[model samples]
Target: KKTVTFFLVVLLAVSLFTQNDMVSAEIKPKERSVGKKCLEITCTMTYTTQQCSTHCIQMGYATGDCLPKEAAKPQPPEYCCCYFEK
Candidate 1:
């Protein structure tokens, strides 16, 4: 009985954490982009800030940065977040 209760509590905690990650994964363009629109490009390799900016320019965005996934845990993938005129 005690074991079952402990297991249920652990499961609940895990579920709550996963739900929070899902919520925070949503992109808020206005808050993060300032006056511009933003795009997230999946980054498979390590990228420097300059490289990310250059890549964004090549893709026709005004600017960009290599940023980690927002509110993520356990080594989230990085992304090249590019900004452009709205």
Candidate 2:
């Protein structure tokens, strides 16, 4: 009887998790843009955002989206990971 109860609880938890995942799922665009080569570059921590932007253009991208890297530990002078299309 105890084993059966544990099994039922586990089953319920799994089912709830699956339902929550499905509810939160959304379709994503297949491609943000086509026929463009996308390049992702991470600038050194010493470089500022403005520098990164300049570097992006020099790397052959018209523009860039620069953001910091996400990590499990605290980071300082956050690095910029820029993505652009050539």
Candidate 3:
């Protein structure tokens, strides 16, 4: 009976530790995609990394008609910098 009790206690402890590790893994930070396109024009002034990225992508798509493969530059307006200077 004592041996059975010892085994049960060990099993429970191992199960608890494994569950904790699984929970921690789920909580880990997700990887962000770098150099993603920016969609919103206002987002440029806002200076949010994700927004700017989306805008760049949209611009690339729209202007792809005019420019060659590498010619289109995702240039944020000077006013965008002005907005943040204050």
Best by lDDT: 1
lDDT tens digits by residue: candidate 1, 2-77: 9999999999999999999888887544554333333466665666667888988898888887666563562556
TM-scores, each model vs. reference? 0.41, 0.34, 0.42
Task: Please give the CA lDDT of all the candidate structures.
Answer: 0.71, 0.59, 0.45
List candidate 1 segments past 4 Å from native.
1-46, 71-75
RMSD of each: 17.0, 14.0, 10.8
| Model 2: residues with Cα > 4 Å off, grouped in runs | 1-46, 71-74
Tens digit of per-residue lDDT, candidate 2, span 14-78: 99999888777754434555222323445555655677667667776654444545546535435
Better of 1 and 3 by lDDT: 1
Q: Against the hidden true structure, what lDDT does model 3 obtain? A: 0.45
Best by TM-score: 3
